[model samples]
Target: MKILSIVGFGGQGKTTLAKAVYGHLKPRFECQAFVPVGQNPDIKKVFGDILIALDEQTYTRPKLLGLDENQLMGKLNEFVKEKRCLIVIDDIWDKKTWKLVRCALQESNCGSRLVITTRIYEVAAYADEAYKIQPLSHDNSEKLLYARIDDGEGKYFDSLSAETCERILKKCGGVPLAIKGAFLAEELPEEVGLLTQLVCLRAGHWDYSWIDELPEEVGLLTQLVCLRADDYAIRVPAGFIGKLTSLQELRISCRGKDAIIMQFVEELGLLKELRVLKITRICRSESIESALLESLGHLHNIQELQIGNYSLSKYRVSEAGSLSYCRHLRLLHLDRLVFSALPAWINSSLAPNLSYLDVQVVVVKDQDMETLAKLPELSCLILHLTGTKLVSVKLLAEGVGYFRKLRFLKILGSLIRFDVRGSECNSSRVPSNNTIMPGLESLEFGVHVRSLKDEKLQLGFDKMLGFQNLGTSSLQRVKAEVNCGGASTWDVEEAEAALEHAAAVHPKHPTLLTNRVESQYMISRYQEV
Candidate 1:
């Protein structure tokens, strides 16, 4: 007369531990219920909500709206088959809806107790006693982060700083809904400048907690149009971002000091109606990258610009066209800024509505992939290639048909060498009648095996001709990582048997995620050949 299943994953609380064991055994049940069954469940409204929670004055709501699902599971198995029931159910997602709600629960030996909550481990292995729910111990996650920042009144958790409560419990890693949304309150209550018509404020915790300063009454939030304080050890005082000149979205992460991030990059040229600018941990200096390229040449209504860490290789192509007045630039993320080329204002007449491009480069030519495949609304490309000398870039299967709206291609590097020129091969290694990125769907790459007794740094995966010229039929997913640091073990079994024989001869047979790693061991491999 006990079912019990709790399982985890998904904020790890499992419906708050099955509502604390159904409120400590629902006063020794005589018919109790608590139902949720989400992820699209409406099994006749869950058997008419368990027959109106087992007898609401004889199943109310017009007696179960003219009963359906097998007459509301035959009046919920004849009223829990003679009483003493305590059902739960809550969030069970599939096992054919838990065998259609376990055929209306009939096994009542009068001490009946069901209780279920899941994230799916084969529906908690059909519960007889499954319970998996772990996560909350580092002394119960610092007593639930000081009882949620003092209601247990330890005076704001005794004024923080045990390195900000171990960086807010190592960034709320034990996840009680991320420590109840990490409200690291140590400051910012100068009566928050009476919320002067706050248009949106969003503080801290995007990745970690840090709010050491920002209260110059948050520049009296002059109708802030969206100011996300994405914590890089916060601290913004001096002219708090030019009084948020009606900011149209500015995510921050300035690491501080360097004259307060060069006076927050000269007050970001008074945010001329900035259309989403994200600045992260910046300050690699050269006078804060020439005052952030002179405040990105006055953000001409910049549309989604992200500039992180620094290093635009001594900018010159007329100072890297200071984002050539971002003509409504659509999403550009330049994180580990490394360009040595590929800048010249990222063409198509200065970013004609560029659609998502992340960059980092030391080399990538063939006119930097034909100036990023002539940009007509380029769709998602993340290319990194920091170079220390092993270059080879070819990729010209009709220049991937000028990526007419490319679909998400990532390529990080450890001394590049892509090569996919006019594919035509076949000695039985299949793949390649040449097509590449034809509406590509998700392809990530990163290799670097370094020294498998260098026959020009032996790359395998059947000599990756840029993944056998990806004859895309909208490829669905292919990730590779490799890096067998100082190789061997037959070069990691010849790079995992040439990535499981190139995902068993790909042609949109996608889903191939390999990892490889080495310097002792690491292997991950997911195939779907």
Candidate 2:
């Protein structure tokens, strides 16, 4: 038998950590119970709850209602003395409560375990072993913030600017609860307006739950430099954003009526000092589209811009000639928005400082590729093909030199065929050594398999020798999502084998991850190798 206690201040994740440990070890015990004893817990009620949790089938609420604290203790001692059990008593406030609870659980030779969580150090020291929990570190704080804000998808978090992330983390001060509450809270307290000197504020729910209203008091924070609210249902009063003229970075989303969203877009034109702007969940309309384009033209100082409607549908903004006005742009992410082709203004002369680009287009023409390759500082590129027909694109040895500084490249499309120049030989043989993306560290692409006999679509384990042609020395991670919708059992096996073989042959031996997608329209579940 053993007792372990965890001590920590409020909001340091003591309960969260205890719950995780309990979940992992509960299956090994004969019986398990988790009971929370708050500041003024009723002794009889706490004991009764534990008895019910340990034997739900036998301990009915009606049957236990008649028992007093002494009777409940008698039942608990008799039950636990014979059975090996795991119990967690969370949020104990005082030593008196602990003594009563401890007396009820009889010591046994059945190899039982007891865990407790408390904010009181002396109470925790009463256990056989005490663990003092500490606040999260800087790296873990960032991970937790991103994980909560993105809801595990990680698409939005990756595109965030370093300056914005740092400001939010500093505000959270390494507390796990503060980090999570900063983004997940449903509504701010009315007193939030009192913090008139606050320079940064980030608040919203990840699940897109409808908030009744954003406190109009938020407009009082005129000194805020960074403000982010991701809730889609927030209806900003007409002049709410205009009040925060000092804001350098702003992110907001709305999925409500069209009139509300149109007004929100028009308000952006007032922020002359804005450096980063991200707006999503927009309901596209002719009037709103015109207003959105006009607003983009006004933000001359903007350095990063992200706009999209997410999964609602592919938003069409091909006529956005106003994008040419923001010459200082270094990062551009157009999520799920489909254009006929690359925007005419996306060239070296217009966006000379461009480094990171993510876009979805119907077809990537030769001229479009040429324009993208000319980006002097380009480092990360994510391209998604949305055409109905198969689009064949080639990466020639000579053209590979253009992406000398590129480090991360991801191409996503089931109907696109990527043919590397020197990798056209037989599946079993290695390709001629032709290094591509010499500085690349991460590579991700999609593969579509319709049949085993079709040579054009055969990217099975044997046909994946194209990886050898990449910058193997700098490569660190490779991910492939194979769609096996119509392929037979043998074809799936061959594809998996090919991925494993490719990973093994690499001289640097980068970590390999394969996502075997069973259908084209379904979500992918990844399997790491």
Candidate 3:
């Protein structure tokens, strides 16, 4: 047994270092498990997680889920009896839980290795060798502080003096986590009200199991241009973020549904200067849903927005037209939401400035394609269509220089066909004054296939190649994802070979890749572009 322990102070990076070592050694072992035991660890859940992580192939998922703690330990013991395993148990706060876990791995004499990370010295004494984590040096601290001091427009750090940098480092005391939390607060005077001028702020890593709410003082930073409170649960006070009149970028993840959070979303429209906003963990709420649809119409200056509902169940985009006034909007990503067809606002008159759009839908229509083609500035587009049958859709049809600036396009879903045989889309014709996606550089197709002799897939590849040649031929990469729906895997192999050969003949000789989902065949070819 190769046993190692990582011991450190509360904020001295014990778990971080343990994860690094686990990632490096995982591939060398026959089976691997990494489990986090928080301050108040749940022993039963921890053992269950270990069994699943170790790849217990002898039992079905349903059977494993139903196993008791003793049965789970038996399954884990059986799995590692004949195979070498690597295990990491992170952030153990007490000895009782460790003893419980030790009972499961005690007699598996298969040359297994274990790594434990803890804040207590007693836990470290249980291992063969203990590694101590240290604080960062002054030079390293300076580099980290300087890299994170950027204002929204990059003016804040450029004006920071050497004396100010030294003062901030001394206050951090060489601890990494402390350095992150205590940034800029010491050098800037409170009487001068520097927080009002601050733009970007990233809170320290939070463990939500203990911490539940944010400081009310956060609402006073009225001039904040960007804010990121990732993976932290916060109870929002009414009009908290709306006070930041100049705020342009905000990224936050909420834990559950609350009326306070809904009010915050409703008031977001008051900050007309916002250009980028991303919000996650949207649960079911009628008030929250109404506020979202009603408030988005007021963001006239919005540019990039990403909204994700929990899943495809109850979420609906009923008022997509609310974004019609977002003339500067680009790079929109909506996940696990349902829309009947393309929204009407995706037209030249409404959202001409759009450069990238990613959305999921159940069906698409011809007018949707026409409207999308008219987006003169569109460069990248991803549509993940899911439904009964995502059969046919026309792309870049005959037009007056539609998709002229398109550079990348990805379409993923069940089996679909591309009809490019129309005379208007004749790829053999000489490059006329008008062209489709002339700047196109990469194309990806993901389709569900019944067999390798999938004629629709083969024909789609042929047409896609022709589509690539019609462009600048500055094409640098092509990828195809084939999801198998039948027993035979030979067809996917042949398809991959054909794609590789096609890529070989291109003038630029771009990189080509074919990934077979049901089987384990992946072909990647890289050539000089």
**Among these predicted structures, which one has the highest TM-score?**
3
Per-residue alpha-carbon lDDT of candidate 1 for residues 182-276, written as tens digits (9 for 90 to 100): 33343455544544554666567544334566787778767778877766447777777887799888898766578877888888888899898
Give the alpha carbon lDDT tens digit for every residue of 1-529 in model 3: 6679898887677877878888898889998989989865546678878877877565445766677788877766677777799999999888888777777777667889989998888878888899988888989888766655654565556566677667667766677765554443322332212334555655424332323444556677776777765455444456577787888887776654477777787888888888888877754575676677677788888899887665445565554667668678877887765566787777888887888899876677756766787797788888887642435445544546656777888877743443342432324443354455667788787644443244444344344333334354567887887665452444444555556766765557778777768653332222111
Using TM-score as the measure, what is the rank order of every candidate, best first?
Answer: 3, 2, 1
* Ranked by lDDT, top first: 2, 1, 3
- TM-score per candidate: 0.30, 0.55, 0.56
- Using lDDT as the measure, name the better of candidate 1 and candidate 2: 2
What local distance difference test score does each model get? 0.70, 0.74, 0.67
Error of 3 at 135 (Å): 19
* Predicted structure 3, TM vs. truth: 0.56
> Which is better, 1 or 2, measured by TM-score?
2
Worst 10 residues of 1 by lDDT: 520-529
Model 2 weakest 10-residue run by lDDT: 520-529
